[model samples]
Target: MVNPGEVPTASVSDLPSQDLVLLDVREPDEWAAGHAPEAVHIPLGELPARAAELAELPDDKPLYVVCRSGGRSARAAMWLNAAGIADAINVAGGMKSWHTEGRPLVGDREGVPPEVL
Candidate 1:
């Protein structure tokens, strides 16, 4: 469990079975390379401005935040939690871990297989 003031984190293997929102904070290029199929992209730098967008997402479920690695997502998760975006949880190890664990990933371009960038 995460202590107060600390962002909660979960590895790909430990993701909850319950439905939840996946938010990707990676850069546009990175996202184009590969990302969780259902994730909503809002690059980390744009999160503050796009805050209202996430408000439209369902709130009953937790939000899983991810980036190239854990660093950005951790900060994003913490900020979202403080900003009342949702009960944010950082996806530890980010896309690297997700790919290594064989979780589904898709790219923006067609006919080109996705890869963690």
Candidate 2:
């Protein structure tokens, strides 16, 4: 289990523009609702088979993961770390918290898409 204090996380307020890679594991619909501008979409189900998609990230560059809340991306971060992508970090509370705080988000904003939220 992840120690509450030990999980490395980045608040939406503190996110930087470059260097770090923001990976969003939410499904396409959720992504359509909104996400971070710097974030890239790579749904969790595709991560294992699509590891090569992240070849662009440097070992020293931080990798931040987020989902609708905190669950999926947290697991994805752990998985990435186990696979030697140790820089992966789970952004606690995910997009919901970001939105709650009125943080910036990208993509569609019409409503929460039905496929994922």
Candidate 3:
């Protein structure tokens, strides 16, 4: 398990959801461009206000946080951990790695091929 800035992290290989929750903490445009098909989108800017909402998630499950790249997700993960969400982990390389490693992706529009933005 990768760890950065005292927070846990996941990799591209662990993506596409392996019976875990994937949170995409990217902006609306980035999320719209492409993201893990099963990810839960919650823009980083909104995390402060929405942190409480995540408390309802199952504690036994891991919550993998992701962004276009690892930057934002790392901070989000740190914030989440400080917020007492121990299972929150950042996806090391984010969607860039996922797409590069041939992982699945989905766009906001139907029938359109997803592309990382």
Candidate 4:
């Protein structure tokens, strides 16, 4: 198992827009509830199948995976790394940290609309 403390960590403020891809692994319902603007909603379960869609991200640029409170994203990052994406990094605190730090988010509390699917 990947340990969060063993990897390099980045605070929300430390995240660079160009050097990182914020991959949100939360479900559609959670993503629709709110997500960081810099984040891409991939849902943990869908990542393996959707790997091709992430080609825009260079192999060198780190992918910062995040979820509701961090668990899922950490696992997703591990899986991505095993699959050959070397720079996958799990955001330690997930969206909970973002909210704790007062970062702004966009989404509907009711849920992500079906049209966005």
Candidate 5:
């Protein structure tokens, strides 16, 4: 088990999606603005009550947490690790870097293509 507050991290550009589960901890509005199509949404504020929902995700796939930036996701990843999901990883720089790195995103928020909120 990882130490408290010692969640692992990964850069957006180097994220290996095939081996991980992308968990978006951003708020609904931010998520609606733009987010990775394959990511699973679970707002940080709701994590405490909704953590059980994560049990259904494949255990072999480590959870990679993300948000608009890296702050909230770090907290969420730490919480997840504490909750027994030992492999939860915080996606460094979050969606901002993902968008800046030209990663593919899926959302239809007017003329706003794919941008970090």
Candidate 6:
């Protein structure tokens, strides 16, 4: 079992699109504001109810979890590991870092550019 507080982490730059499952755990408003286009939206609050949805993902690929900052994603990663998704990892610095690094984001609200809320 993966230990709590020991989830693996990687910077946004290190995350390549083809290799892993990007799980965005932020809430709806935060997600709608901006998010990695390829990321799967399973808000942290809904994870318990949607845990089974993750079973369809390939086991060979690790699950990279992200939120507005690192805090919520870290909790989500720990919870995922505890719930038997052993390869879940927290995206260090989260969307804030992703935005700062100039990574592409999907949604923009009211003509505003995509940004971490």
- Compare the candidates by TM-score and give the number of the best one: 1
Model 1, runs deviating above 4 Å: 1-5
Rate residue 12 of model 5 by lDDT: 85
Better of 2 and 6 by lDDT: 6
- All candidates' TM-scores? 0.91, 0.78, 0.86, 0.78, 0.87, 0.88
The residue pairs that clash in candidate 4, if any, are: none
Model 5 C-alpha lDDT per residue in residues 1-117, reported as the tens digit of each score = 555347688898778856557899998888888889888898999998988888888887788999987888888888888778546889999999998888878875887776667
The clash numbers for all candidates, in the given order, read: 0, 1, 0, 0, 0, 0
> What residue pairs clash in candidate 3, if any at all?
none
Q: Give model 1 RMSD, 1 decimal.
A: 2.7
How far off is residue 18 in model 2, in Å?
5.1
Poorest 10 consecutive residues by lDDT, candidate 1 = 1-10
- Scored by lDDT, the top model is 1
Ranking by lDDT: 1, 6, 5, 3, 2, 4
Cα lDDT tens digits for candidate 3, 46-113: 99888777877677887889888899999888888876765788899888998999878889967777
| After superposition, candidate 3 runs with Cα above 4 Å error | 1-4, 15-17
Off by over 4 Å in 5: 1-5, 17-19
Choose 2 or 5, whichever is better by lDDT.
5
> 68 in model 5: Cα distance from truth in Å?
1.2
Q: What is the C-alpha lDDT of each candidate?
A: 0.89, 0.77, 0.83, 0.74, 0.84, 0.86
For model 6, give the 10-residue run with minimal summed lDDT.
Answer: 1-10
